[model samples]
Target: MTSLWQHARRPATRDDDSWSVAGNVYYGTGRPIDGMERPFSPEFEAKVRHAYKSNGPVFALMTVRQMLFSEARFQFRQMRNGRPGELFGTADLALLETPWPGGTTGNLLSRMIQFADLEGSAYVTNYNPGRLKMLRPDWVTIITGSEEEPSLASEAIDSELLGYMYDPPTGSEPWFLLPEQVAHFAPIPDPEFQFRGMSWITPVIREIVGDTAATRHKLKFFENGATPQVVVSLDPSVTPEKVKKFQALMDSDHRGVDTAYKTLYLGGGADVTVVGKDLHQLDFKATQGAGETRLAAAAGVPSVVVGFSEGLAGSSLNAGNYSSSRRRLADGTMRPLWREAAGSLAQIVNVPAGADLWYDDRDIAWLREDQHDAAEIQGLQSRTIRTLVDAGYEPETVVAAVAAEDYSLLKHSGLYSVQLQKPGTGSGAPSPTPPTTDPEVP
Candidate 1:
């Protein structure tokens, strides 16, 4: 709990003289948001939204064009789609429509923290994998069936789980990517006939679809589990050929889409529709530093960016974009904004989803990285940006404003870029329709 300001320096690390800057510069700390619960302020969104529309749009226009369209024309499409009026009015974001469970207690923010504690790490929805276990026995069984890692779950006919869970047919796209938890709990539940244990599983299934195979999968698996000889039948939800087709479209049409969520949502752009399994773990990573090079180059909105991100890979694109830019000022000091952010990580707000790095108001958010999503990020970012400008900051002061919202914004390499205003060469291009709203809000 000792802060960098409190510690006397040993005077040096490596070849740098940042002795005084040691832990002081790290941007993750848990802090309290003073009046985040207050009503939405209009001015806040205008400036922040404008910043995103301008900066992020150009970046997004740049990338989606080469990948999806041909430049000049695409940027035009971007503008047309970005008409603020279409998404919102001239006011700040909508009166926060927090999810069911999130609206209780003091509010969503408080509930988000509580869920993180009860469930271990912060996630974006009431659909928390940990919580869902009680609702979806198939997931509970598949999850309980493994001792593989700390974060794991199982479910059939549940696209949500299929996004993050792994089983026999977990082909090419990789259904299991997070494992920080203690993994593979003892006594794995029989994938079939397991839904019976979860009181909510049956209903969710019946509602999504009538008493079809998926329902039967839940019914027979959970209901007949007690019967040895007459148990439910099991089949890979996504057949091999279908998996191949899905993977192809995923790679070509929906690249950068968060696979975990994608497995649930299943497509891309404004046209993407979601279905299937119900297995998605949440890892709340939400900022890429308060507008640093990484963020700017990618044209990410300073507030909650709501897009999906494919897991990092050494793409031909990324492989060729390395840079040598550094932001140490003449006096060997970083921007004051950066300095400030490093000192406060836990209190950042409106953090976006699919961010390379995000700022936070709580250190615990870091531990939940596996299942984090766009909703948590957007919520934090949108709200925080509003708080900053409302306090009398100018648009030019966006970086400082974000740093003020939560110091962890400095942890991002973008923390440096927002200062520089030049997206480094290597960061991937911007996304179109910019992946949006996390699992919770939408």
Candidate 2:
């Protein structure tokens, strides 16, 4: 039997169907080709890290991650007639349950999705063939081959060449990983590019940057020695030394949170004048609120779903709109992402032919209302079945017609008969009896 490790380590076949690069392929900028967009360089990553300082992006990211990780269940399924038949036990189950020896599947998936969201790509190598070892997106690069249809780098290097060059942060020499050895997940893939996937942060980087700046400004406003307006006018005759001493005195008396509200007394004919704008006047509230909305929108997360303070606006607060927003987020944003991740994971996991990975969202509280609605609909179906059966339709026919939504079943009854009696004819009078005749008389 071929060992799992050998199966994973075997270099990708260089055939027409294979996704192998023919010649030596070097990394090109390691960036998505969105026009006028910056590459996923070190500086860009720094800005992404800084964006976390802003409450909006953090909330959005957290909301997405938490929702995706929670209320999700995975199982290996058997394939029958090109459809998933039932949950079946496979080696993939154990691997997914514990992606790494120490890590849980949830944690592993969370890290992969988080990296994919922030860095535009996530690469996790199969260490010792099938065990997962997540590679840092920043340190890894795709070394392509000469052929446009890329082939693996065959030359031996210091480390194993699975298909990627991994340079550890602790000043280690670069190593290689096979394409099959790594599970790459990308949310928004560039249509033209093969190696890179587009990041959600790309479209919203502007909003995130604005939100970060706004948050910083607000922080500074509170941190500065002076509040909105309390100008201290000093005597012209006072020496520069005296001015310095007075400035220090005021700072000591009323700077920062601890002494912010304390009163200050100025001698030597100095005066304190109230100045232009206070924090309220500047309205960081509305500015930051707008920025938060933008960030959430760019992230494909509704502000209401993320529970942002500013998201408590009228539309979001309304029960109907809020429900609609939740559905939209789940359907439009999270479902597709879940499908993408499942598809990628399928590659690493030994998914049997005709069977694919799928997500079960039946347990998600956010979507429980849908279940409630379905129950109500089923109740209506039950009522319909009862009415039809009571009206002389076969029980099977009624169930098939109302429950299955297949009217054809109604006519499939062996009687091949139609009822001419009008509805509510239970009390109608019966016709007189006819004379009986024996078959032998004919």
Tens-place lDDT per residue, model 2, 1-442, is 1222222232322212211111212222322211111132453355345554334556566557655654565676555445455565566666777777787777777777777766677887766654678877766655443222112222212222225566555765456666677777877875534556766655655566566677777776677643766778887898999999989988877777677766667797798888857788888778878877777777788888787767787777799988888788888887887777777777677776667776666777767878988899989898888767666678876775664465655743333223655444434536557899999997
What local lDDT score does residue 186 receive in model 2, on the 0 to 100 scale? 78
**Candidate 1 positional error at 266, Å:** 84
Q: How many pairs collide in each candidate, listed in order?
A: 67, 15
Candidate 1, residues 1-442, lDDT tens digits: the string is 1221111111111221111111122111111111001111121222123322333322342232122111000000011222211111211111123224334212433322222111112222122332211111111111222222212222222312111122222344312322232122111122222311111111121121221223234444333221122111224564678667765654553343232223324333213332333212211121222222233233212112222232222341242221111111101211221222211211222222222111222222222332355567767877866654544445445454353443332322232223333544323535335466677874
TM-score of 1: 0.15
Model 2 stretches with alpha carbons more than 4 Å out: 1-41, 44-48, 53-56, 76-91, 148-162, 170-173, 376-442
Q: Which portions of model 1 show Cα errors greater than 4 Å?
A: 1-97, 101-106, 119-442
TM-score of 2: 0.71
Worst 10 residues of 2 by lDDT: 13-22
Best by lDDT: 2
